[model samples]
Target: MVNRFKDPSAHLEIADLFAEHDRSSLPIELGVSRRTLFRYRDLYVHLIETDEELMPNLNAARQDPHFQKINERLGHLLDRYDSKWTEMEDSRAEAFYDWVPEHRR
Candidate 1:
């Protein structure tokens, strides 16, 4: 079942999974790759910021009985990327962008 939200990009992957009656399995159950799932979560976060209508659905997702399990799984997946990002940043002391603005200069 299609969720009734207006964002087409999230309609299938994110929204439908969060819908009240869609009956689709959780993202992990669907064999969604970790990177793809992260992309979906990022898209969902953007939608939550820009589209207030999604808030209710997001809240529902948060309150789901499986929320804790899902959260743990996502967190575990993110830990690898987080560790890599930290390591990369620590490896370089150079500022990523070092241009001084005209006024500051």
Candidate 2:
């Protein structure tokens, strides 16, 4: 019999697995790559941020220990990139101005 948990289309379920387990081990458990796990997380965050109908679920996720751990890991990754992003902003100001209208700049 085919295992339902191994369903390839179960993106959300895989995301929940990532949230509840050690991220390093989840890829092996789910039989997917770390990159796939990251994509699931990005999609999950997009849903939480943009899907108004999911607010209740989002609130529950926020309270979940695994969710919190995933969130913290993402936060740290963003923090690590923030400095480089700021430097890019400084270096790319001319390019940004060239691309953006004066009113929007």
Candidate 3:
């Protein structure tokens, strides 16, 4: 499914959050430097090591196919949020530009 997420960054950050499971199957698509992805992977492993609660949730959520659907919907809404952000950016002017020193140009 096309990710509907608002922030593309979420694709990575969130995927990493779910990585306690093998959710690496889904992949975190947020644009990342290879180094950052590796770092997040390390962080995920650390979280899994320290937290007992996350392990079961990972198992439970993975078994539920519905969680995949939830991920899709979450991505979709995030896309909408991105769209709104674009719209807002398009509508903007330098509201404070008038306060600038002309000589600063």
Per-model C-alpha RMSD: 14.8, 15.6, 17.0
Error of 3 at 18 (Å): 3.7
lDDT of 1 by residue, 36-76 (tens): 12243323221112223333444456656676554444343
| Top lDDT model | 2
Kindly report which residue stretches of model 2 are placed more than 4 angstroms away from their true locations once superposed: 1-52, 79-105
Residues 36-63, candidate 3: write the lDDT tens digits: 2222311211112211323344445554
- Alpha-carbon lDDT of model 3: 0.37
Clashing pairs in 2: none
Model 3 regions lying over 4 Å from their true place = 23-105
Candidate 1 stretches with Cα past 4 Å from truth are 1-52, 79-105
How displaced is residue 45 in candidate 2, in Å? 8.4
| lDDT for each candidate structure | 0.36, 0.38, 0.37
Residue 51 deviation, candidate 2, in Å? 9.1
Superposed by TM-score, candidate 2 places the C-alpha of residue 82 at a distance from the truth, in angstroms, of 12
Error of 1 at 54 (Å): 1.4
